[model samples]
Target: MFPLERQQKIMDLLKLKKVLKISELTEELNISVDTLRRDLNTLTKQEKIEKIYGGVKLVESKFAESSMDERMVSHLEEKERIALKCTEFIQDGDCIYLDSGSTTYQIAKYIKHFKNLTVVTNSIPVVNELMNSSVELVIIGGKIRLNEQSVVAYDYIFNFDQLNILKAFLCASGITVEKGISDYNLEEAITRKKIIDMSKEIYVAADSTKFGKDVTVSIASLDKIDVLVTDANLNKNMIQKFRKTNTKLIIAEGP
Candidate 1:
């Protein structure tokens, strides 16, 4: 594999396993020990990982946020399924808010049929997707977050307050029964919080993998979310936990 691809695989493995030995990485990548060592050294210098005695571990920090590219490739089918389900709640001429997230970005694909929908979003990808569509696109302009390709600024909070959003669709880095909805970036979380307050109804589009995981910042409580849209792979135990909350769950079955 190429060096960049090898490094991305190493990072993905580290995210899944937390820590991995050099031998394991060598076996997985089918590369020479010397080459893997060089790759690890480069990653270490970039502060993405730390070398231990015989292995490397991810730099576990509260501020560690995954890039848009990584998230886009992680759960492609599940996100698409959930996005399709989201269309059921949308109608022609409705004003809605779409957060800067991978799943929410997918919603743009299924919303093309809406003739007079007004979409307010902070995601650059979502903006590009609907720019030429019949829907009126409103971008939350502010400081651009390069990794996630979203905008966040304190001034934009007031802009959200001025609009009457019928529904706001969001995605989270993690979701738990207690901590509610959370994300890795504080600025994005703040932006989401503002949108949540402005909208009359709230919907969270999250994959099953996000359940039970608590990340750095909490956006809102479960009670604030009117509906939860996820893939059908969600287990019964998780469904029961969500049942205890005020948020109604919608399982998106595949085609």
Candidate 2:
């Protein structure tokens, strides 16, 4: 297989088992141990996976699962405003899952005050914010992606599968009425799809600026989103587009 094909397969395998031994990868890929190690090392540097003593493992986190710092700085204010409104869905004693992104990071800040809740996530920043909160914080163990400073892998999903998620707050790089929600990074896309699939009610926290954009990977349909929280700058026609579906859209006034 070509390098891209090989890398895709490796990503697939990581999703299945969360961890891979170098020898096992060599046998499966019909490559030398050195080549397999090289691949693993390259992926590790990219923050796609973690190189353990004798194997590799996927990064496990729910929020900002694969993003870089530059993207986080793009729309800080809009994200925070939407995140504040997204917190309305969170209640005490609820088990919440937050997918990582610049917007979702704000959601973390807004929900930290809820008592007796369990915040499950894979974002390093989210963990940093709520680590001292009264809420129960369960950090999913996995490899860390450097670009997004988020975590991905079956390891996180396996744990999320065991939980009863009350609300899942997600963020995306793109949200189109026709094409649905999208994200650029492959690692982020996989984890966001898993978040929407595994949660009971999916709450999307995004800015109005993201409305017409579409990206490489389609993670969720606009129809599948249970609630959308955004700042008040949304155009009227677009609001009608979301209204065409049963999805509940909530717009917040500027902060």
Best-fitting candidate, scored by lDDT: 1
Q: Write the per-residue lDDT of candidate 2 for residues 1-255, one digit (tens) a residue.
A: 877687778989988776667777888899987777777777878888766546766764433333344345445666777887777778888998877677887787777678799988878888888887787987666668876677886763456577777788888777888888888778778877877887889988888877877877889887788988887888999888887877888898884
Assess candidate 2 and give its TM-score to the true structure: 0.69
Q: Against the true structure, what is each candidate's TM-score?
A: 0.76, 0.69
TM-score of 1: 0.76
lDDT string for model 1 (39-157, tens) is 99899999998775567777746447656765675567889999999999999989999989999999998998997899988999999999878889988868889988999967734
Supply candidate 2's per-residue lDDT for 244. 85
Q: Find the number of clashing residue pairs for candidate 1.
A: 0
Which residue runs of candidate 1 sit more than 4 Å off their true CA positions?
1-63, 156-158
lDDT per model, in order? Answer: 0.88, 0.77
Error of 2 at 109 (Å): 1.7
